[model samples]
Target: MRPKLLAAVLCLTLFGCASKQVVPTHNESRVQAEASLKAAESAGASRVPEAAQHMEFARQQIADAERLLVEGEQEAADMRFRQAEADADLALALARSIPLEREAQRATQQAEAARRSLQ
Candidate 1:
């Protein structure tokens, strides 16, 4: 009887360990997206408005994902997270365009010229 009890306890411990862990909060996903956006901007991205729009969209998706996760819809939440990630990637690509970069450079030069004139 003691051996049977030990076996049951061992089985329970193993099962507990094997269960999937809880998903992280939506804030974490937003933070990750924001970090990616900052990295892209630091790398000379110029389409700030477009990137901002995409970031907003990603934020919405993350909210949805979080809601689904809270409702125990793990698969749906995962899908939303994937979509949010894709949106962030799209924003990064748009921000990295050469035309936008050139526009940003021209704007920076103009601003510097204005500053110099004021000085």
Candidate 2:
């Protein structure tokens, strides 16, 4: 039991001390982020000031990720790419809500009219 415990501890320690090794496959993430940003833009995110911040943040994050990638920081680049993607997604979602808001307003007006007719 003592030998087994020692072996397990040694294995854990060795694994813990090992340097993190991640493949530099950030190209896919970069592409995904860029596509998302473009989608948000094409979806009229810029037209809605509410999503402007998200679109800007996403752009900045993509730039930073590119810089980090050039600096050979794969992990940081990947994180930034993911962040950019999320921001872009938020911007797109906000842009999409515009039509939904209009629909809801129209529905409310119809409901008000129906109630007035009943009265």
Leading candidate by TM-score? 2
Q: Per-residue CA lDDT of candidate 2, range 23-109, in tens?
A: 547898888899999999999999988777899999999999999989999999999999999999999999999778989999999
Question: lDDT at 95 for candidate 2?
Answer: 91
Q: For candidate 1, write residues 28-60 as lDDT tens digits.
A: 665665666566556544446777677667778
Per-model TM values vs. the true structure:
0.49, 0.70
Mark the 10 consecutive residues where model 1 has the least summed lDDT: 38-47
Native-to-model Cα distance after best TM-score fit, residue 5 in candidate 1, in Å: 29
Show model 1 residue runs off by greater than 4 Å.
1-47, 98-119
How high a TM-score does candidate 1 get? Answer: 0.49
Local distance difference test scores for all models: 0.75, 0.92
